[model samples]
Every structure is written in C-alpha cells, then in structure tokens.
Target: MMILDQFYAENFGKVYRSCGNCGTQFKRIVQINDLWAVNGDVVAGINTNFGDTATIRTTQVDGVDDICVKYTGNSNGAEPVEIGSGPDTKNCLYSTSDIKQL
Candidate 1:
C-alpha cells in the first residue's frame, strides 16, 4: 500500500502511517515481548481484523522534503492576506487557513 503521510517521534518506537487511496491509517509500535512470546525477545507489530497481530520490522522512512513554514502573528492580525502592486497582488499561502494567535 502507498503511504501518503507519516509521522514519527524519536525513541518512541511508534510510527503513524496514512494512506489516502485505501482510507486506511494505522500506527505501529515496537516493544519487548514477554517470556511467553514465541518469536523473539523484541517484537514489532500492527493489528489487523479479528484481533490478529502481524509481526513487522519497523524502520525510519524519509521521503520528499516537507513544506515547513513558521506562522507569525500580531495582536490585531498575523499576516496580510493581500499584497500590493497597484492593487495587483495575491494572498500569502497561510492567509486562507484558520490559525490561532496568542
């Protein structure tokens, strides 16, 4: 399955995967297995239907660069929606989205 977006936190041993086409989103976690475990001392898995768990090897995956932008704010407003060139201007990328100010 193709993964559309993924988020990971270092040392958390957790991975979040989101697929747009299949409408499937799930998280995988890795942990140490108890003595009764059969496969190995450490196990990584994700749950499927019927409460079944499938063992998997989790790895850090990185892809294309993401658009990381910082939004600034002011007491009145953060950014101006329109630009100026004799009234010929476009809105900033962050102008359309709803954002909160502190």
Candidate 2:
C-alpha cells in the first residue's frame, strides 16, 4: 500500500506546532510558503496546485538555538558534570582532553 501523508496546516494566512507527549512547544515555523506549487491556471480554467519537496520544521529546547559552540566541563562527581549550556549546544556529545565536557 502506498501511503501519501501530508500535514494540513491551514491558517488565516499562518504557524507553530506542538508535541504529543510532553505537550510543550516542540515545533516552530520560521518560514512558510503558501504556494509550494501553483501553476496559476496554466491549463484552461483550472488552477493546479502540486506540492513539491517536503515540509521541514525545527524545535527549541529551553530556548537553545545556537548549534555551533564550545563544550567544556569538569566533573568531580558533582552535578553529573553538565556541559555546554546544559545539553543544547552542538557537538556536546564529543569529549576529549582539549574539548571535554565533564
């Protein structure tokens, strides 16, 4: 079976999406194009609107947006050694002597 699913987001002209489980602000639309594919009545008196590409959305956790930053941490068995803005900065997973997160 072929399943063609699309997110029907109709507004007076507009967006933000929510999560299912946590119910927090999960998705926020930065830009939206109402007309992904508008032929503008190309063939006779019919306006063909074909959707192209996919809808891409993003989420913000604890107001963390910057993905490129440095992570440095020191953990002497205290507070689990939190890193880089508290698990939001990019490349926070990697650990090393120079760029280490404790």
Candidate 3:
C-alpha cells in the first residue's frame, strides 16, 4: 500500500492509503507516538497496520509542491459532504458516482 494523502495536527493525524490495482482506499487514524527532525524537517512517528502496530514515519512538506485538493462551500444549497475531520474544519475532498466534483 502507498500513501495517497495525509493530514496532521499536533495530537493526531489521518493517513489515506490505496490498495494497488483494486482502487480501494483505507484511512488510518493515528496518534503521535514519537517525533524527531531530519535535515531541518520534522518527522512524525505514527502507527500503521503493517504487522502489529508497525511504525511509519512521515515528514511535512511544502504544500506548494503537492497536488491541490478541491475545497467546497455550502452556499449553493447543496449539502456539502464531510470529508475531513468535521464540518468545523471546513475541509473536504470528495467525488460522486455521477458527474460531479472529484
């Protein structure tokens, strides 16, 4: 499995992974296990499902170098789907089965 996207806060984070060929997505919610720095970048230690709470590491990168995710607003009377942590966060990434946002 490879990471598709990730979002992190101080206490917790969510990593999204995709299974190869099958196009299945999995979300892993994790708490901070440890932290360190490498080459001026901060790396986070998180738990994974790869064999008994396997630890995985990640470093925060510049968002300008990453793909842009679509953000939606709830002004058009269409119900905005909750994709991020909650509605308060106002962060969403979604796609519908029909010809809609992706």
Task: Kindly list the per-residue Cα lDDT of model 3 for residues 52-71, writing each as its tens digit.
Answer: 11123333423211111222
lDDT of predicted model 2: 0.20
Candidate 2 accuracy as TM-score: 0.14
Q: Which of 2 and 3 is the better model by lDDT? A: 3
The lDDT per prediction is 0.21, 0.20, 0.24
lDDT tens readout by residue for model 2, 1-102: 111123232221112211112322122112212222111110001001111111222211122222122212222322222122212222222112212111
- Error at 55, model 1, angstroms: 11
Which pairs clash in model 1? none
Rank candidates, lDDT, best first: 3, 1, 2
- Candidate 3 TM-score to native: 0.20
Q: Estimate each model's TM-score.
A: 0.16, 0.14, 0.20
Using lDDT as the measure, which candidate wins? 3
Reference-based lDDT, residue 83, model 1: 14
Span of 10 residues, lowest total lDDT, candidate 3: 93-102
* lDDT, residue 97, model 3: 21
